[model samples]
Target: MSKISTLQVEKVNTHIVNWLITYAENAKVNGFVVGISGGVDSAVTSTLCAQTGLSTLCVEMPIHQAPSHVSRGREHIEQLKKRFPNVTNVEADLTTIFDGFKTIVPIVSDSDKVNLSLANTRARLRMATLYYFAGIHGLLVAGTGNKVEDFGVGFYTKYGDGGVDLSPIADLMKSDVYALGKYLQIPNSILEASPTDGLFGDDRTDEDQLGASYDELEWAMLEEEKGKISENFSGREKTVFDIYKKLNTINQHKMNEIPVCIVSNDIK
Candidate 1:
């Protein structure tokens, strides 16, 4: 697509800020509770919420989190507080909670299965923590997921990071989030930092796990959405398209509501 202009970015910023304020007001909520993961997506989403002039509680939920990653998240909150007075910070370390689960459960030797299960558990723990704060304060849990991850590939864990009361950046592409981050003048350290889920202990980035760049995946997603995949087949283009399709098929469940077994009244 075309390069996003400064005016367009500003407009988006204003739109999201206004939307957050209006959404909260309509819901009769006090403020927004967002999990600040020190990633660009969270940085931008929290910044938008802060700009709304509403009370924004930026929670840092660390479960076996790296010191550097935790520092980045705290730094972003500190920087945001300087500009936005309504911003607040809270750190909830869930490492103990996670370790408790491991201690009780039988150790599984399957590396991939065990790692993924723990990563997802971390996400769910953070989700629970965010809601806990939101519940006590009567606030909404603002999600940090962007379009490419939430919709294009469903990269978020189901009922984990994907569980939220509101998603301010869900419609924004990853590139667009970067543009907004720059527009809002987010902390440069966060901007320069690699986007990782911080779920894995290995420091593997989202792209590393996805096996493709956000730009490539986004392009393929856009093409897939337009239903033009069958138009032509080439080398790299075809490869990207195939990868996008595979991700969609694998993650389609996440994009939809939870499935339930339906029963007939007569049968009951």
Candidate 2:
């Protein structure tokens, strides 16, 4: 086991909580907003927000693709209520909303493409709901991405799950994240869940699809930057290698700022 600094970790969490409250205050909102997906990242964020003495609202926005996530989401919300008695449990069904919108949004006939599109559409629709509620209730949306994910293969959807007024866990790595959860007393159920986007079925986990565990990928990323490379790795190394290559290839648009048409130094 690595010699992780518990005190330093505690300080970081404290800073994060303080920052979140300040962000909500600056946004002219009474508290923070969040989406709990029966996953650790959101669970931690929601708990921290509620403990910050802010009026936190945790919205469970699972779609039809994965009802398991909905069950888990309810479990998490109930757990959050026990841990942070101040957070509101807002259950919203995004399935009908997405279904209604799908008609106007033309999609390719490809089944795989359609599934991917639906997965992403659900995320964006949920975010829209969060923002709408945040606006009406005077709250700021809290993002739940972590360092391991932020550095590894792009996991979050742009403008969809990625839309947030503040992110509390953007610096903590995955291994370190579990420890924080323990310290915060987050329920075992959420902490133990195989991390996922819940964009599809129950089996659609992040590690399986991303082709690598968060630990290995994060290590590779940090080492590569320091001109140090680990040649010896398990079979999983190949998975990480392939995923890193694939993300670089397919998610290239994420590497650039939003599309800006470069033209002859001429303004229209």
Candidate 3:
């Protein structure tokens, strides 16, 4: 049972497709760029952008620790080309650059922060690569984040995957993201693959981090979006909302286009 009303889903999905065309034209870019991670979000974004009739550059950026993930990303790219021949793939090993940074920055033993930092670094590096190509070739970077992954949990890194000229899936729930994939006629092979960041291979999953399934995420989001929490909420619902609020503040920093400065007019 989806919290998103049928009318609401239809309206939002329509807006998503329309925005793809509008953003591409308004940005004066003939195409879009996406770092496909073999994840549902990226695959959906690439297909949607292509469906809008814009050429999309799908990048496969994998750290050396997980080169196999790049192969998965490549498979998705091949899938993208079969549907939209305008899609192109780029293979970039982010480990080299991260290793370079490791030299300058003291090595840390904490896997939590280290993995988080490395994951974010990979995201930012992918964006940097995407924009470099877009800038030289005249294209827009199509961000691959959904409402469930981004707005609800703040799963994306600021200025990394979260930063983009347009967010085609920003308002969508993850369940609906899958639903939209079906609506868009995406291939089953690409859709059936596990959703992963490929940051660490210890079976680390998105739901493991969030402690909620995509269906549960949609249920909570609908409750919050519609202000149904006043009716009643489970213990887990409260936790989800608390996490949502915390991320709201964190991504607030991500959403800001410029930093606020306390200036005494500087050296004047």
Candidate 4:
């Protein structure tokens, strides 16, 4: 993939910041509240929110989170506070809350299903925490999803990380997010860290679960948009295209709006 130039980066930065300011002003909200995940996406998003010079709250809700994730999240928050006076941070440790939830929930025989459900629960807990802060402070919850995850593969948990008042960077690809992160001078620790949801309480990466990397998925998405099929490629390319197609097919529920049964006037 081609790298984004410096001029493009500067333009995008200014554009997103101005857009955020306009949205907040029109919505009659004070500012934005973003979840800091010690990853490039959240770091870039929080930085953009801070640039608006509005109240930006960086909340860290860790539930059995990795130590490295905690350290990197705190590092970025401290750096953001120093750079923008409008930036503030809070840590809501949800470890005990998670444990309590597990104890109360009934046990299941399928361990894999149980584990997946619990991982999603972690994301939902964080989403609720962010909304609580947003409600008390009159701020909008800013989402940190990129295009590849949000639309291409439907990688995020529905109503979990997907639950948000507004999405700031959902249109940008993963590579574009990193380019913007570099332009914003985000902490290197976060920039270099592997992308993970950190919901499973382990060191598994996004690739480990997705069976393909972001770059590969991005390419597959573009190819599919151009009406290409898996037969058009061979070797690892074929494998990646198949993987992307399977995920995109199965995750349509997350990507589409909730189904609502409409009744005719006669029936009513």
Superposition error at 197 for model 3 (Å)? 2.3
- Error at 215, model 4, angstroms: 0.9
Residue by residue across 107-131, what tens digits does model 3's lDDT show?
Answer: 5889789877877877778788888
In model 4, the Cα lDDT at residue 41 comes to 95
TM-score of each: 0.94, 0.86, 0.83, 0.97
Top of the candidates by TM-score: 4
Tell me the spans in candidate 4 whose CA falls farther than 4 Å from its real position. Answer: 1-7
lDDT tens string, model 2, 83-116?
6767887778877787788788878879889888
TM match of model 2 to true structure: 0.86
Query: Judged by lDDT against the true structure, how good is candidate 4?
Result: 0.93
* CA lDDT of each prediction against the hidden true structure: 0.88, 0.75, 0.72, 0.93
lDDT of 4 by residue, 35-122 (tens): 9999999999999999999999999999988999999999999999999999999999999999999999988999999999999999
Clashes of each: 0, 0, 0, 0
Candidate 2 Cα misplacement greater than 4 A, ranges: 1-7, 65-67, 103-107, 228-239, 259-268
In candidate 2, list every pair of residues with a backbone clash. Answer: none
